[model samples]
Target: MAHNALPRPSSLPGIEDLRRGYTPSTHEARQSIEERSKQLRLEQERIDAELDRHIAEMQRLSLRRRDVVRELDLNHALLAPVHRLFPELLSEVFIHAVQDPFNVQKTDFAVRVLCGVCTTWRAAARATPLLWTFIDLSYITSLEDPLLRLQLQLSGQLPLTVTAKVQDQAMQLLLVAFFDGMSDEDASRVVEITVEDDGVVLSQLRSRHLATLRVADVNIWDTCTQGELGFLTSAPTLHKLTIGVQYECEDDDAALAFPVPVIPDLPCLTHLILAIENEFPVSAFLPAISQLAPVLRVLKMSSFEVSAWEETKPTVTCEMHVLHSLELQHYTHRFLTFITAPALHAVTLIGDDAQLGKEDPTESLLDLLTRSRPPLRSFALHDPMQGSASALSGCIDLMEGLQRLNIEDNERGVTSSPRLAAVLQRLVCDENTPPMLPELRSLSVQCRGDKSPCVHSDVAAPLSQVRLSRKDPRVCAGRAVAALE
Candidate 1:
């Protein structure tokens, strides 16, 4: 390689006369200089011609080398073990390349790429129905009929997962492609469905054996008035349901425009999450959720108003015996007063003072605790009432199994500043207190900055006493709230 890179000895001529600055002083010297210059020019031209010929030869060889290398690669690929595998085995490899069918997006379409690779791969991909089972129609909102038709045809008899974003303006196209495209048998094969859009309805949900349905960031307008959403009432196999609605319209009009909801018994549902952006009546969901109480293990509701549920009240107060976790935000205590959960252990209440104080909410919550008598283990209250000391004491008295307690941003009145201090002081000092919340393990309190300074010293005094007399409580305090004490 090194020898080939260097210029040939005859190709380079040394300019010794020029370097020595040999001036032509006489006629003979001038003729000798001209003859030498001419010889050098002739040699240079010959070298240039030789270089051009070598470059042309190198180009020809390089093309031949590339062709040989390509042929070798092709032969090696043909001999690979993967090529010998059965078409079914190759189809499995294609499925693995896709990773997860449910979460696939239009941009990273693995099935389509696999089909376009070669004739054999295309045949394998086309023959495998599972590879095309999950169809993401989110990007093709204009209802590109060919793609939908291809997906449906390829999916065959396998269970399908469908995801789409049906915009309000594109409802007709979505309906024509998704709703009208499928026969009852084809729709029944659908196992999961997700829709993210504004004021759009999917009537086919009623006919399908869907197990998971998530309709996120929706604006339910006049479209649901056709009773298309009644599928949620009788979806016997549906296990997980998540619905998020943006409420920016008149409440009564929106309620009336919505299809009259009919929530029947759901025996298989384990997870239910309902989130409304604005204040829709929490009572509106009672008809549906009451039926779910028997089987639900986790229930979360966020951002809703509370009003009377229906004119014909339920005669029996449904008990949620299986419900273990409950999370609520921007909700009133009226909901607690309505239902009872005996097996409830974890509870999180996130709200402001007004919502807690609405309709004398503390008493309602206390009554709920008294009635349900849950083996309460974990409790959290966000921005609770000013008089939380008494409420905390009462809760501890009722729930002897309580282990974790979390409170946040308690800054309402003069008494509120020392609420934590007072609760601890009574628990440690009072002879008759009997070690309130004896099993307490973790206590977290976050107070307003202005109040913590004055309250810190008061709370600190009981730290040593509580530790000496009883087991140490894991105390976490912030915004100047005293630790341990």
Candidate 2:
């Protein structure tokens, strides 16, 4: 072969370069293998470093995620079981769990969260049309039309729930919207409607399944005007009716008159609470009660009026049946004039002495107990007016099945700053007229403030807290008496 033009058969281009000047020997080959091994090691080290950094970053991210979770505000959640999942039931539970009225945003968020849980839950949540039932008309500037629109919208979906706070004009319009939204076909879909205001406009809301209706802060002055109200023909499904009547009238008789009360026959009614004041006319309710309510099991009647005489007859006559609990708050002399409940099982009387008249409130209370259906199982007498006493014998005569008796403001006339220690010894403390209460199981006496302001300032001022007797041997059977000095 010519010098540069010819190449040896064993000398290939790439193979000859690998071999270089020396022949392919074991040691040389070993060196090449070692170099390749070193390169691989370097690459592995770089990869290891990158992996360590990546791991550190992942750990940091995890820590940040945990921190975020800790800072999150948690709402009350009923940890339901995963097995039997019912989204609508969960939503109902959440509705009641939301005790904070202003947390409507949270409520909406909860509904969304539940819907996002699973497909089955989402379907269930959607199925319950009443799930989104809430009325918040706190801002009453453009109330009537806006509220009416909202009411109509809610009426279209499922049953409606009315919850809002508005004053005079807005309240009237809200009432109108409520009545107007109902269809004549059936009222069963309307679940619950609650109103918290002192004013009310009589509207005919005859629902089929409307279970509960409550109205708070009822003012006598806000009743139906001469031509404003006639008759409420549709509110027959109301199971509970709570009315707060603020007394501003000097004449009790005229104040209590209802413009027109044409109540429908309602047998499902069970509970009635009326806080009438300033001479609210109970007679006006007669037209409604005579035809409307029949089965009342719990009746709570109170009046802020001192001369609310018109309600006495009805308060007594209307309340004489199947009552299990009775709470008489601020019992004016007008109620004591001729009040009676033959079926009352539990009686609670709460008021200051100033609200009472010359008659001993205890005697009047005992008189009712005698007329009650059976022995009052629970009796609470709170803070009677000054010089409070009922011939202990006479008061005990009222109860036939007395199980609990709670007496508050037991301090008599000792705050007059007189040295009647002898009288206190003979007629008060030492004069234990033997326990006449046979079946009395629980007795609690709250010796807090006195009826007279003088006594309260001087004597009752020191008593801030009193303890209840628990460890007594007769906890269940013995007459429980709580005495505070």
Tens-digit lDDT string for candidate 1 (1-485): 88779576653443566687866689997888799999989999999999999999999999999999999999998999989999989989878877665645633464557777679988998888777777766545544556666777888888777666655556545654565556667666776766654343544443443333322222343334334344555356777677665535455765563233444455687887777554555665666787778788888877654333322334666688998988777554446666788898988777655444443334546777988898989888764445557875676678778778776644444334465666667556333434566666676656545445233455556644654545433332211112233
Which portions of model 1 show Cα errors greater than 4 Å?
1-134, 141-146, 149-159, 183-189, 196-206, 209-228, 232-234, 247-260, 304-318, 353-363, 384-387, 410-417, 424-433, 441-485
Candidate 2: regions farther than 4 A off: 1-131, 137-159, 168-171, 182-187, 196-200, 203-221, 225-232, 246-263, 281-294, 308-319, 332-340, 353-359, 370-373, 385-388, 410-435, 449-485
Model 2 C-alpha RMSD vs. true structure (Å) is 19.1
Model 2: per-residue lDDT, tens digit, 350-411? 75556444334565575565655355688776644343333334555556467776766534
Model 2 has an lDDT value of 0.49
TM-score for every candidate vs. truth? 0.58, 0.55
lDDT of each: 0.63, 0.49
